[model samples]
Target: MQKSLLIALIITVIGAVAIHQFGTALPAYAAFVLGAVLVAIALTVVSNQPSSASNAKYSGPTKTLYVGNLPYRVHENEVKALFAKFGPVNSVRLVRDRKTGRRKGFGFVEMSDTGADKALDKLNDYTFQERTLKVREARTQESSGDRD
Candidate 1:
């Protein structure tokens, strides 16, 4: 645990003990002050806790494949099923338009390394639903700084 968090926990314990022993003996306003201090310590601890977004990036290598030329009416389950023929699929994410929420005709498929390689070789240019599929490794999008 972090040092600041440990210190805050120790302070909280001390405050709880003091309040329990002297709550009634001490003046009403004094008890409120102690309670406020404990609340502040709790808030500090919560704020210091790490956020999920901070750890969103996968640190290790991932076998994520970019799937293009998908039929607009294609479903995520269909994509998963198609790739599952190659290996155990981890996940499938279909791209969509932000405003209309319409399918973007492309998406990503996550699977085992061997599965990804097989899918790339076999699925690329493979016809499905009258469209030739474009299967390849998903490339990290280049960050575009401030748009405005």
Candidate 2:
């Protein structure tokens, strides 16, 4: 339906017609392969058409939120409850001062659904208590940084 896709489809039709017209010059299998390749190229080009959501960086918004400026008293259950309004949460953890057992002022929470995107859109830049939340897709450590 997109202009680019339409153009690609048109080109594919033209190429198919051309191939059929000249296809007798080649062996049957070779002609078949060539036609298949052309069709594949056309589909690939069409599929590359940009989407409106292409600008949406986070693939999963609600799955994991990076909580910053968390109050020392905040618990994992409390955080889960806050996000649960959007969807079920799989897990929540406060990245803490492991030795001191003190809140690290930040943590990560994972929600169960792709609905995280919706939750993120709704809750991003929102204030919980005095701290504004920054919700985003949780990147695997390898992607964001080295885990070790």
Candidate 3:
């Protein structure tokens, strides 16, 4: 955008010089003003975009649990029930295969921060559904080119 603005400013200055030197039309001055305004607006927009590193901060729902060893038929409601005892659940999602639609043995659970911290402290290595469930604070995955 800076490069484009530099190119545009140069073009506008050249046009202004041409109009002052040899042209006789008012529209040339208007064209220069329009170009200048466009360049200013573009620069403002570019400066306003968030830096790529800014997304390092948490922005969405808090990760309450990184559930693993989930049974194939375990549904979202059941997962919610298991953790609802800790706190209000924000969401429960069962990771599934694209084609087979089978459980991926792991999923994410979101909850209020208060509940999340408690669950993290108490649920690690706890047994559920005959499997030793490992729970922890979930980490966000950077853009993988596949997501909502």
Candidate that would win on lDDT: 1
Q: Using lDDT as the measure, what is the rank order of every candidate, best first?
A: 1, 3, 2
**Model 3 Cα lDDT, one tens digit per residue, 38-97:** 667866797788865312333445655788877777888888877767767767888899
The number of clashing residue pairs in each candidate reads: 0, 1, 0
Residue 7 lDDT, candidate 2, scale 0-100: 66
lDDT of 2: 0.69
Q: TM-score per candidate, in order?
A: 0.54, 0.52, 0.52
* lDDT per residue (tens digit) for residues 31-93 in model 2: 556766777786877678886432224344345667667767888877877877776666788
Q: Which pairs in model 2 have colliding backbones?
A: 62-116
Candidate 1 or 2, higher lDDT? Answer: 1
Kindly list the per-residue Cα lDDT of model 1 for residues 4-93, writing each as its tens digit.
Answer: 667766766667667867766876557556766876877778988887432234344349899999999999989988988887677899
Off by over 4 Å in 2: 1-62, 146-148
